[model samples]
Target: MSLHKDHVVRWNGISLGLGGGVWGGSVCVRLLGWTQLNDLEIVLLLALFVITPLALPFVFFQNKGPLFSKWTALVVFLQPLAAFLGGASFFLPAGPLAATFAAGWGGFTGLLALLGLVQLCQMRRRHRLSLTELCLAGALLYLPAGGAWMVLACWGLQPLGFGVHTDLLTAVHFHVIPLAALVITGLTGQALHNRPATRRGVCWAAYRIAAIGVLIDPLLVAAGMTGAQITSLPDLDTVPADLLALSLILLTLLGLRFVVPTTVSRVAQVLLTLSYLTVFFTMLVAGTYVLGVTTGAWTITIAQMIAIHGLENALLFGCCGLIGWRLRTGQESQRSRRGEPCAY
Candidate 1:
């Protein structure tokens, strides 16, 4: 990593390598009960643990202000929290998140709103923010914000504590939040194209509309609307399926980046899409078991997949940054040709 004149410390090989070790060690300890322990080891382990998750920011985003850094740190830490919350659903008894239906759902709705606000604030450039920019910011915010809520959902902690079941967590948080976030994303997108926001408006509107289908499908299944419960292996078929839906939301969020204005931006988009696609693919494969395709010693559930998708969604901001960079470059080139300062 390079230390610049501004005291901006960028990511380097050592940090990344050490971060990997931290991640691998933690996973090993949790899963296999494997350890070569000591006092120093424990201290090093604790330090490394935090470093690994936080390193992505160091690698991706360099120097910044204190508030932004703090927020980034919080978001980074929340990655593991998402898993804790979603996983807790399986381990805990289920019920409404709040004591009253309206209260709990409303609380969730509000938290999501605040999350969006924070995103909007962070997603600006030096100048000239556009509709596409807002959407890119919205997509990025979906991950950490959604993960924070999901973890709380999994913890069975609701403002109203309505006593809903864990089975409803994925649909409630994963489905509903994005359905809300994408509304703005679509709006921002339409506004960017200067086309009166019709397509963006409709696309986002369609997400909410489609969510009705998602919510209704499960209830229908309960009422025998579709399958006759010829049960299979994934035992928790719903989890994987829900996770797939979550993954799809994430993957689709970055789709526009594929047409980003530069070769590097296009490549980044492709790679990001691929990363998210892998998460989705794994979810689908595991979902097959969740849906009862076959038996295996290890199985992937929809919840696990959803956790992966959350992180993938959070990375959209990076793609957005690239988009802004490209537009600036294009603007500068035209300005040079026309004997003027870059303006678009």
Candidate 2:
């Protein structure tokens, strides 16, 4: 398919806004609104489930140039589907087969992740796809089985393996995967969305890791998994937990700097950037420190929960706006400063 590099000048906002908006908005509807979702909510959900994934693909098709790697469409769409299924399963009646299935989906997330890695390898070696291709890879990894049944069977069948070492399972499933996907999607989306964006290299790897974690928060809430349960708050000083928290802080610091002077300026864009950093750091600190090794009295004060879920998703899309803002801001600033004619 031909790409349209400049098809939709502001298309990034449409895709990203729906991506994160549906994620956060779904939580609100599922939890508080119960079965009584309104029209706007329905529209939002539909957009996410259907229209949103197409956003990236549409950009690619329209651009006649590299707006996204086909991988982006796959993952952005699949990740949310997997997350939604995982979350929705929580409300189902518990049983042996059902529990086994749910547990299997959880395990399947890893296999999907491995698939994503393979896609990345292809890109590194010879794939024509852009960084967005990883989005689909990530979705396949997290979605349980739809990515590839055979792959899922081979990897996820190892319940004994995960059970053999709960810590590894906990670290991978509970901690690492979520964060990784979130960071990756956010960063890649930004790159792909750029009219002419730069490849971040390995420097932005942490962003993907943290992003996976952020993406999962809404799913967790939707599925009825509270943060306290996810991370026990009582014990505070485990070595791994401490390290993870530190990493989050470092990432936030590095990522936060992205918002200043160049890439973004709007209040919404800045808030989104700040929120993204906050959520990543918060997960790193709370998940690793208070929740992972040490069990403390869990607190999900309404305000705190709202802020956590709201912020990450907000930040996810917000970053998109910032990228667009940066592009527009830079173009305008350069033109005015240099006395050059702007793009028509």
Candidate 3:
């Protein structure tokens, strides 16, 4: 993909638009205090409103072969609509209305996941499961689980007594995890779609490892929330969580270094690189924070962790990754139309 001036400008314009919304919302949430939303909640809401729209392009542009169908398009459009409504519902006083919106979001997310599964099955039948497909499958698999957790949180369930606000946990489950998966999938599709078939074995292996870690980390969190006694390794209480986090970080680094396209613009390259780096940092901090909490070695507040890792994950990884994918895909699409060699 050529780094044309027009493409850069358009990408910057979209980023500025999304970034401005997030910035304005952050300031407003602070000053207005209309809701009891904390910094992380505000960022997550802003991410849903902004980042999900950016991902919509992937629905149309990334579709190829029998892996995706027209039904996938409908699901793509509905997912964000449901998510936006879910985010908007936060403004309402805690009641049935908000719960209904939460359910709506969860239901739509479940539908999207089902469609993704269907596509994954079809791709597998065709013997063409790539890293992008794996990412998409992971996204679909985990998003609804997050949404289910959100629904329970909205219903005022708090079995773990984590001291974090139930609503905040709901937002993290419902928005942050799925958005991260979607952004990663978009980046993978955009970056590797046109690359040579070499290294596919390595890419697929990396994706499977990372995808398992991604899926399991969230499930472990959910299990913790439900007060399930996760069996710990002898003399290593935090081993499971730490291992999952480490696997995700390492696999993400591997993919960024080897799988991502080198032909993208410098700015896009930087953003994509930073997205993975931020993911590594966030996972590291989260793992350490979890160990600190479990061991009582440190008294870091959930609010503090959210303020640091959550903000970085949302802005750097979720938002920037989406923009980077958008720029790369758009350039590739243009090149394709012109019958020029594309970098994929």
Candidate 4:
């Protein structure tokens, strides 16, 4: 990335962040007398406004060659805008109107997922299946699934025997947890993609492990949710989810250990390391909570979970990780263009 390009990306991120902040604040303040939203829902709005806009450009713009087109760019632009409309719809008294706006957001996300699928097919035709591409595809494809859940939540239609609140929670879960993790991991993998053969192999191994874990975690959650209902076994929900969380935590910790030393900027290093460490602790706390659910020992309430895991995932891990990668890569690109020997 050129210095000029870097400025553009930064300006775009800041503008999106400010827009999201203002929109979120106004919706909350104005709609108070109409409908009261929960912490998790507010966090969902923040993830849509604050995180996704910042992430989409950083994650997909680099791959604009095959993955992004003019039409696709329009879709990307519409996604957040639609989400803003959907957020406001929550303040509306009518359920049908709320559901419709939410569906539009979901439709945009579904288009994004289709774009990701197209990218994968292009890669397949080229006989290239890299870890970075897989991560990018996973990140894009997961959004619509979350959007579908959001639509269902808005419609007050719980299909899988889960409550409307749980559907909404699942929407936030997919959007933040898997999507952010995939972006951060994909960006890290992209950084490592240009290394020497020996290190590149190692990088691929690390990325493959972590990416698989991140992608699978959501499926396991859904399976656990459905399985619990079918077999009348309550442990079905927590046991597999807790185990997967543990695996992801270990894999992420390992992946970070491999990638962090390669970062040349001290600021980027600190931020990335902090983001990785934040996920480690939060996932561990989540696993423990699941264990408590299984053993009847101790468990945090849903509100507490949202306050701790939800906020930390979006603010600390997602925001810090994406920005750190942008800084790290920007410095590397500048050094490379200057014909200087790059450290990492």
The best candidate in terms of TM-score: 4
- The 10 consecutive residues of candidate 1 with the worst lDDT sum are 39-48
TM-score of each: 0.36, 0.44, 0.77, 0.87
Arrange candidates by TM-score, highest first: which order? 4, 3, 2, 1
Give me the candidate number with maximum lDDT: 4
Mind giving the per-residue lDDT tens digits that candidate 3 earns over 220-314?
Answer: 66555444333433224345557557765865676576545554567777777777788788888878887787777987686777776778778
**Model 2: what TM-score?**
0.44
Q: Choose 2 or 4, whichever is better by TM-score.
A: 4
When superposed on Cα atoms, how far off is each prediction in RMSD?
11.8, 9.9, 5.8, 3.7
Give the C-alpha lDDT of model 3.
0.62
Clashing pairs counted in every model: 23, 36, 1, 0
Query: What digit string (tens of lDDT, one per residue) describes model 2 on residues 1-344?
Result: 22233323334444455456655666676678565433222332332233334333322332222323443434443445444443333344434443444444455455445545665566676746554454444444443432222222223343323231222223223322233334334443453344232235544555555444444432443233223335643232233344445544544554454433334336634644654465465655355334533454555442353244333433343334334334544555678799975432
In model 1, which runs have C-alpha deviations exceeding 4 angstroms? 1-19, 34-131, 139-273, 276-344
Evaluation by lDDT, superior candidate among 1 and 4: 4
Q: What's the TM for model 1?
A: 0.36
Model 3: worst 10 consecutive residues (lDDT sum): 228-237
The residue pairs in collision within model 4 are none
lDDT of each: 0.38, 0.41, 0.62, 0.73
The weakest ten consecutive residues by lDDT in model 2 span 145-154
- Model 3: how far residue 256 lies from native, Å: 4.6
